[model samples]
Target: MTGYTRASALGPITEFVETRGGSIERIFRRVDLPLALLDNPDLPLPLREQFKVLREAGREIGDPFFGAALGRVVSMKKLSAFGAWVSGAPTLAGAIDRSGRGLNRFLQTATVLRFQVSEAKARWSIEFLDPGKDGRFQNELLGVSYLIDGVRHYAGSGWTPTLIRSTCVGAEQAAALENVFQAPVLHDAPVSAVEFDTALLSATGPERKQPDFGAEPPIPPPVGLREEVAMLSTIALLEGSPRIDWVARKLDMSRRSLQRALDREGCSFSTVLEGLLKDRAVALLLAQKRSLTDIALHLGYSDSAHFSRAFRRWTGMPPSRYRS
Candidate 1:
C-alpha cells in the first residue's frame, strides 16, 4: 500500500472559491487550469496545486481540512438519489438502507466513500493518497474535520463523533488531532476512523437536517492548485526518481502540457519531485525504527550510499546524521 487515502471532498472547491469573490477565470489562468473544468463537477483536478491552494488560502476558508471545506457544500448525490427512491418508507435508516457505491458520487477529486457499516456504527475511511510521506495522518485529520460538518448536515444536529482511531501513534499526539475532532481520538490503535453512535443510523431520510454551523469562506481560487496537488501525487507515486513519461501518464497530460502546467505554476516537475522524495525520506527515517539500509530500499535506492548522496543533496546531512 502507498499508505494513502483519496480525498474526494474536493468536488466543491470551485464553488467555494467562486463564492468568496475569487476570480474563477483569473484563478483558472493563474493556476493553468482550464475553464472547462467548472462544467465537470466530477473531474479530478491535480493534487499538488490543490494542496497549495488549500494551504495558501486555508485561513480565509474558515476550514483547516482543505478537502472538508469542499465536502461541506456537497450532497451525497448517489446516496441522496437512492434514499429518495425509497422515500417515507419508514425510518431514515430504511430510506438509506445499506446500499453502497464503490465511488462516493458526492466527491469528484477526493476518492472516498462509505465502505462498510455496523448495526450502530458506520466505518468509512478516505485513502490519504499522499505522495509526500506522512500525509496519511494529516489527511485523516482533515477528513474527520470535514466529516464533522458532513455528519451534522445529514444528521440534522450537532452530532459529535463518539470515537476516533488512528495508526499515527506517537505522531498523532504531536498533532493534537483530538482538538480538531473535539472527540476522543485514539492513537496507535488501529485504522484512522470517525465513529458515529448507533442512533445516527436510524435517523430518517427526510428527518435529516443541515446543521447551524455556518459554512466557511472561500479560499484563494488559484487555477494551479489542483495541478500542483496532482504533481505532488505523481512525485509520491513514483518509487524514486520518476521519468517524464510516467508522470505524464499519471496526470493524464502530455509531457509538453505537463511541463507547461508546471511552468505556469512557477515550479518545475523535477524540483517538486526532488523535494517530495527527500521529504518522504526524512519523514520515514524520523518516524520509524527501520534501519538505514531498509529505509533506502523502501525509497527505491539500490544501496545506502546512493540514497545517502541524494539525501545529502536534498538535505544538508546524511540520513544517519539527521536521525541522530
Candidate 2:
C-alpha cells in the first residue's frame, strides 16, 4: 500500500534540512525525485518516494534524530487543510479522532491511525499498510513526534509520553529516540506508538479565534456533539448561509436542545460559525488570490465593507491592511 502524500509534507523538513547544512536538491536527486516537488506543496509524491527522501535527508545531514527534529517543528498551519480541520476539534481526543479519520481525506492514503485505550493508558499510533518495515524508522519517529505534539496542544507543551514504542531496534536507535522524546523507548516493538495517561484525553483545546490557514473539505462523521455542530456549521458556511436551526434539524434535535448541549460543553453555534469564518477568511487572504468582494460574497457577507468591518472586529485590522 505504498500510496501517495502531498509534497507539502516536506515543507517543514525542507527548511530544516537546509538549516542543518544538507542540500535538499542533492538528496531529492539521489532519491530520483523531482526538485520541483519542493516548489509545489500540493503536488503528489509517491509515499515510498517521500519515505526515501526522509531517510536520505537524515543520512546526508548525519542527524540520527533528524526525523524527530522535523516532527517537533511541524505546525498545524503547515499541514494545510488537514491542520485547519483538526484545529476545529474541541478537545485533544476529538482532535486525534479527527486526524485518524481525516488523514486520508486531506493528506494521504494506505495508512491507518489508531487510538486505543487500556486500563489507565491510551495509545496513539500511525502505521503504513505496506508490509515491509525496513526503511521506515525515520518516518515512524516523525509520526510518533507528531502524536506527542497533538497531545501537547492541549496538555501543555511540557507534556511527555509515558512510553514510546518503535519498530526500530538497536540500543543506539533507541537512545536517539529517548533523547528526542525524553522518555523510555521500547525498541523492536510491533508498532510505533505513543502511550500517555488516559486522563489527558479529556484536555480541552484552546479557543480557536483565528486560524492560520483553511480549506473546508468534507469532514467525516464526528463522534461528539460539539464536533457534529462544527461539521454542520462548516457545511452551512460553504453553502453561504450558516444557521444553527439547520444543524439541529440535521442532528434530529430541537434548536433549544442543541444550544443547551453546547452550553454544557461551553461552546455555542455562533462561536463555531465565527471560527469557521475566520479560518476561511485568513486562508483566502494569505493566498492573495481573490478580491475582497469575491471573498465577501463567498463568506455570505452583504458586501466587502461589511466583511471588512467584521474582519476588523475579529482581528485588530481591516481586511486590506491584514492582507497587506
Give the candidate number with the greatest TM-score.
Answer: 2
Show pairs that collide, candidate 2.
none
lDDT of each: 0.52, 0.77
- Compose the digit string of candidate 2's lDDT tens values, residues 1-324: 445567778777788899888898888768645566566566544466667778889988898667787888886534776776676678888888888877876687667889899999999988887443434778887878777787888788788889988877788888877887788998998778989999998898774433333543332434467766775565456547577877786555899999999999898888888888998899999999999999999899999999999999999899999999
Residue-pair clashes per prediction, in order, are: 27, 0
Using lDDT, give the best candidate's number. Answer: 2
Q: Which ten residues in a row have the lowest lDDT in candidate 1?
A: 211-220
In lDDT terms, how accurate is model 1? 0.52
Candidate 2 RMSD to the real structure: 15.5
Task: Evaluate residue 65 in candidate 2 and report its C-alpha lDDT on the 0 to 100 scale.
Answer: 69
Residue 47's lDDT within candidate 2 is: 62
For model 1, residues 1-324, the per-residue Cα lDDT tens digits are 112112233335556766876544554455444354444333334444455445433444444553434444544432233323333324434433422332223222333435357776776554444353322343455555544544554567556777766555676472565665556767785446667765765565454333221322111222453444444444343344456665665455798888887787788777776676787788888886888888888667789998899999887898899998
lDDT of 2 at 117: 94
